[model samples]
Target: MISIENEGKVKHNKSVATKLTPIEYKEITKLVEAGIYLNSSDFVREAIRDKLKAIKVVKIRDVDYEIAKKEVLGYYRSHLEAYISEVAEDLELDLELVIKITNELKKERRLDEV
Candidate 1:
């Protein structure tokens, strides 16, 4: 178990065990010694967060793409300027896909180039 302190409150998190290859263990240890991470748990937590972000973009369908495009357009209409990265993060979409949609809008003259 690990105790995390947030906003003057302490929260306890359960510990999970997993097996790693010798090389992987060595690498993690070396990184910790180099101060890349606080410890193995910190590294694992960061890895898990990165994996979750990657997993968020899977098997997007055409309908989903259309919906995202409409959302992007609506957001642009409301905002004075369209920031592609902000739009992607706000909509929880892949940045590349958002850029593609923005480019399409520019090509169609639906959105002005900024």
Candidate 2:
């Protein structure tokens, strides 16, 4: 078991056996030797954390999509204009997902591009 902390929140992780290629193992060992990571486990944990951050999983359903679309339109109504990135950050949505919703709204003549 491993205990990891992020943003003052503690997460407990279970140990799992993972196989690494020779080159991958060597690279991790080199990093560990250079003090970049405390150990191989630390290196692996950090890599997993980075990958998790890079990938976002959103379960999109018609109901959820409709709700998000309404929220986007509501935001545009209050603000004259907003960047896709800004809307995504403010609404706590994935950037690509927000872009998709915005594009659909534009096509439907509900939103205008400025």
User: Can you write out model 1's per-residue Cα lDDT over 36-68, one digit (the tens) per residue?
Assistant: 999998999999989998885444333488998
lDDT (0 to 1) per candidate: 0.85, 0.85
- Per residue, candidate 2 scores C-alpha lDDT tens digits across 36-113 of 999999998898899999997654333477788888889888987999877877777777878999999999998988
TM-score of 1: 0.46
Model 2, position 42: C-alpha lDDT score: 93
Compared with the true structure, model 2 gives a TM-score of: 0.58
Q: How well does candidate 1 score on lDDT at residue 94?
A: 78
RMSD per model, one decimal: 6.1, 5.7
Give the TM-score of each candidate.
0.46, 0.58
* Each model's backbone clash number: 0, 0
